[model samples]
Target chain A: MNNELRIMQNIYYDNSATTKVDPKVLKAMLPYLENEFGNSGSVHSFGQRALAAVDEARDKVANFFGSEAQEIIFTSGATESNNLAIRGVVDNAIKGGQKVHIITSKIEHPAVLEVFKYLEKNNLVETDYVEVDENGVIKLDQLEKKIKENTVLVSIMYANNEVGSVQPIESVKKILKQVQNDRGEKGLPLYFHVDAVQAVNHLDCNVDMLGADLLSLSGHKIYGPKGIGALYVRKGVKLAPIVFGGHQEYNIRTGTLNVPGIVGLGVAIELVAKEKGPSKLKEKLVAELKNISDIKFNGDLENQLPNIINISFLNAEGESILMMLDMEGIAISTGSACSSGSLEPSHVLTAMGIKPQWSHGCIRISLGRFNSEAEVEPFITALKTTIEKLRKMAP
Target chain B: MKYTKKLLEHFQSPHNQGKIKNADGVGEVGNIKCGDIMKLYLKVGKNKKGDDIIKDIKFETLGCAAAIGATSMLTDLAKGKTFDEALNISKDDIVKALGGVPPIKHHCSVLAQDALKKAIASYKTRNS
Candidate 1:
């Protein structure tokens, strides 16, 4: 293979986009794929075996977030979970003929943001966006004011995928509680949903600790298989089904269960739960890149996830930087992988008040558990050279 | 967008990538939405036939690979052509020269062609 083809095995720094499946997780999933291909819904010995495995996996995944297994609902991925959380609640509110209002931040992932947009466009609900600071943290006082007589849902991402800014979810939950108390006479139902896809592996995700009534997470983010994820609905939250079919998952999300994928996710979450994340390597990467001039960190380093480092190179275009790094057999992203092909700059960064030019220049380096101290220097070297070359060529 | 090997080559070492000093004509194009900016410069001279030709050309672009590649390829295609011929180099020709740009990034190539047309127009007006 040529250098371009060989570059496929380059140092991957885009783990936040997706992670390579851990070998151990694959090993654990093999038996399910090979011999135990029974449908969990079937009423046979094979079905019972599959059902037991899925149940155990659910328990493991629920334990990862300090929840009961029955509260976890398996879905395709975080996108589905986010939709189930946001739309599910909205649909229920609509059925009750409530004047529903939804609150989200300007920097939410498109999974959450687009759902709200769809709801708003169709006149299903009125949506208000809480403003985020430069660090991408939602302003609590501003959020408090956005709460109105009919506010039904508040969906905020636990961590931004572009900038890795960890939102103060705990404080956000407290604010929601206070607002609920202030509106107790009217008894307007308010639910707090957290898109924790980016936070599950790098942060404390205990649902009670974060005070999240609904949380969405994907298995692939934690080095598990793709196409499998889980959503946590706190008991008695009264969520409606967005996808209805065979009445699986408490009739909330219904599809034939993915047996092997669930097995892989179970093992993957267990493994990540035991492993220390890429914090040291991240620190090393930041320190090495510090030598490059005109480079600015885009998010809060102290309160952010340990693995993701978002930076903007002044006078350099992000797509150019991305291509140059690819040429050097290094991998990174200009923004969310979902919108990499889009011409617009990152909505998350732009929402954080970054200038359009600077947002176009932003690049995210999201390390993974596989990254080591040894790769840090080489990555820094590649980044420095790429930025220098792009800046030199800049008008 | 997946760039062809040839496109990547030109993008890595774009030709005529610096601004020209006191040029005969200058054209600038920017996509406020995409945040891509390109400035094209032309140094026009007369051939033996006394028709205006581009004697030298340079560009300064702050954009994606396709934008830079289109400008680089545009400069190469327009360098020896008369002002009218340079104007005839369409966005498709530049896209073809780069092998292809992603459909979403075709605007980058279009921006390049626009910049060249504007440059030639600027030259004609200045000399007219």
Candidate 2:
């Protein structure tokens, strides 16, 4: 058994942070670089070919999200997508002579929450954090109570990256529909923005079911290249450009198109759609880990995205467990992808009303397609041994 | 990955585990929230030959396996050593006892050393 364990090397389990680029995605991207290098904006045969590549990628992305090809605005990833969505709405609302207000959740990824925090601090917008339950689902009554006549936008996630909790976006859309009918307003409809970075391939995503006016997704989160993402701006949902430059992504994002990146993202989305996604490893891992004593799952396991598990070992520190796991060649995360490398306990846990002691003991294990049940046994055995040893060491 | 033979020995069939209920000295270190806490109990002093060696050393730890393994190995390292000499044990020596820990958990072995210092300090304070 020991000899078999020695044969293993580099057990990469921290897929939620990022994934190794798929070979197919890489193959699609290669031509745009070394060989087919040309600025998409230049007006020659080379440039026109590059421009065609960009359009092809855009159409694939639009098909992936059930949106029009023109609606997909390329940006630097989910962070930029979120910034563009929030700032765009605020800039447009302020210009329309309305006091802009925003409603978000306590468990929002920092990309969305931090921007709202900055707005609230600067008095640029009135912001309200609709509280989430232990599973990190926003309370509909609380959301309704916070919404005012001036609420220009409501930002939420299609799925949380840390705990994999899927939000009831259809329910949120229903509430928004009721609010719109009560107010008798047609023009300047309330902006619904969904950060679907983690949901692109794992779940069946459609702009209609999400009922979002704007959707943000990153390429790297779904086996595509990093540093590139798309923002879905529904037609007639007018938002001023937050990033200034020459009209590149239809005057919405003003920069030369990242041709290789777009191609990779398109390939990733197409493969997932064609293959119908094979991420059952997440459920298998979670089911096995659930059998352990003193282990608590952090989110709504039933309705989760089937790719993440946030677990806490009683009387065990996450870093200590992580170090030992690293020794065993099994990789894992502490909590949020954005908060990696920071020693602070997860704010997501704190928001769920988890005790501070429990927060420090938390470990986030996200599964990817590359993982298999054959690889999971050693992880469980290693985790159990590490936890038992740590418990005995504590005073 | 297989733990080194020494680490597994310390982890599986560890020596000097549990607490000495009437311990002559006790050393406790690390904050509760950090999740690594170690308490060392020592029963030290002379034999009929006036030897100053430590008679018995016991530990109760609440932390990860490596920490427990280190704590377990630390006691074995200190046991039977001359009372004053045992106080001189360093983190390097403890890591050496377990065939070395992964770099990140070097602090756990270090904590065990600090705990030994604390236990020795308490013994001196009580006897004086």
Tell me, by DockQ, which candidate is best. 1
Model 1, A164-256: lDDT tens digits are 899999999899888788878558678999999999887899999999999998989999999999999999888889877897888888988
User: Which ten contiguous residues of candidate 1 chain B have the minimum total lDDT?
Assistant: B1-10
Error of 2 at B128 (Å): 6.6
Q: Which ten residues in a row have the lowest lDDT in candidate 2 chain A?
A: A335-344
Candidate achieving the largest TM-score:
1
Clash count of each predicted structure: 0, 14
> Over 4 Å off in model 1, which ranges?
A1-9, A183-186, A336-342, B19-22, B121-128
DockQ (C-alpha based) per candidate is 0.60, 0.30
Binned by DockQ into CAPRI classes (incorrect, acceptable, medium, high), candidate 2 is: acceptable
Span of ten consecutive residues with least summed lDDT in model 2 chain B: B30-39
Segments of candidate 2 deviating more than 4 angstroms: A1-5, A96-98, A186-188, A277-280, A336-343, B1-22, B29-36, B42-128
Model 2, position A360: C-alpha lDDT score: 64
Model 1 clash count equals: 0
